[model samples]
Target chain A: SQTIHQWPATLVQPVGSPLSLECTVEGTSNPNLYWYRQAAGRGLQLLFYSVGIGQISSEVPQNLSASRPQDRQFILSSKKLLLSDSGFYLCAWSVLKGGGYTFGSGTRLTVV
Target chain B: TQLLEQSPQFLSIQEGENLTVYCNSSSVFSSLQWYRQEPGEGPVLLVTVVTGGEVKKLKRLTFQFGDARKDSSLHITAAQPGDTGLYLCAGADTGRRALTFGSGTRLQVQP
Candidate 1:
């Protein structure tokens, strides 16, 4: 079975600080990866998606950026965080042939 | 842009009660999926309806796709407290690799 892992299940960062969240999937290759953020009491908003290594598509314009360094490794980063950047971030993966996607445990980031 | 709109943004009911959540869209979808997310966790896939007017059941949860493929619904029979979570509907386009998700419906089942 495939499993997705996200680092720093919870994070507390100071305003203007750098941010880095990592997501890795095991047991699958060349899977589609996505980054999503959910603010308190709000639905999820897609931030970025990667089809392959070095290929990323941004769904929304925000301070965050995404990178696919390896086939199974995806990273979400920001040079300087803002208070509005605080939210629950999720990493998801889907097979190119499937109709459903699987998500990781998620990272709760709080920018104070 | 294609979008899925869900109704009853928030639902609160007692355990053993029944409820239904609806997802509607003006654009057709190739496939629709239902997911449940608990606090501090990622959304988990519950079911997917592909063909128009298709209905799928998973235990107490039943999912139905509209005949036009532009809407869907999730019905929970005799809900349990464990079912309390955020319910989301996502649609996949015919040629797109990504899905457009609904705003979501937060369901609370009190025991």
Candidate 2:
């Protein structure tokens, strides 16, 4: 069984503060990783996806960037936080070809 | 960019009632998926629908993929309070790796 872990479970950051959110997958190797953001009770917006280490595809160009440092470790970072950057962040992993995804518990970020 | 539209953005019904949520898209999709998300949690994949005009049933939930692979629907029979959550439909566009998610339909079943 594969699982994804994301943290911190909740975050409160001031404007212009640097941000880092980490996600890791266990029981799988070379899995495709994805970062998604969702507004309160809304649909998910794709932020970034990685096919392999050091390879990231960004969907929406905003205040966020993603990096795949290890095969199962993905990081989402921002140099400065914006009020609009606050939301629910989710990390997911899937096989190389399958469309199915297993998501992490998610992080609730509040930028004030 | 492909877009999916879900009808009845918010639905409130009593337990034992039946409801259907529809997801429509103009662009063709290679595969479609439905997910349910609870408050403050990540969405969980409920079912994946492939093959045009395919119908699949999971307990009291029925999912159908349109023949053109451009639309889908989820019907819940005799809904229960445990079924209340946010329902989302996502489609994988042809040649695309990421899925396009619908706006989502929030369902609330009162007991």
Q: Best by lDDT, which number?
A: 2
Best by TM-score: 2
**lDDT score of model 1?**
0.92
- Please identify model 2 stretches exceeding 4 Å from their true place: none
Per-residue CA lDDT of candidate 2, range A1-112, in tens? 8888999999999999999999999998899999999998888999999999999999998989999999999999999999999999999988944488888989999999
RMSD over all Cα atoms, model 1: 1.1
lDDT string for model 1 (A4-70, tens) is: 9998999999999999999999998999999999887557788999999999999888888999999
Clashing pairs in 2: none
Tens digits of per-residue lDDT for model 1, B7-98: 89999999999999999999999899999999889999999899999999999999999999999999999999999999999999877668
Error of 1 at A100 (Å): 0.9
State in Å the error of residue B75, model 1.
0.7
Q: Candidate 1 versus the native: TM-score? A: 0.97
Tens digits of per-residue lDDT for model 2, B49-94: 9899999999999999999999999999999999999999999865
- DockQ of every model listed? 0.65, 0.71
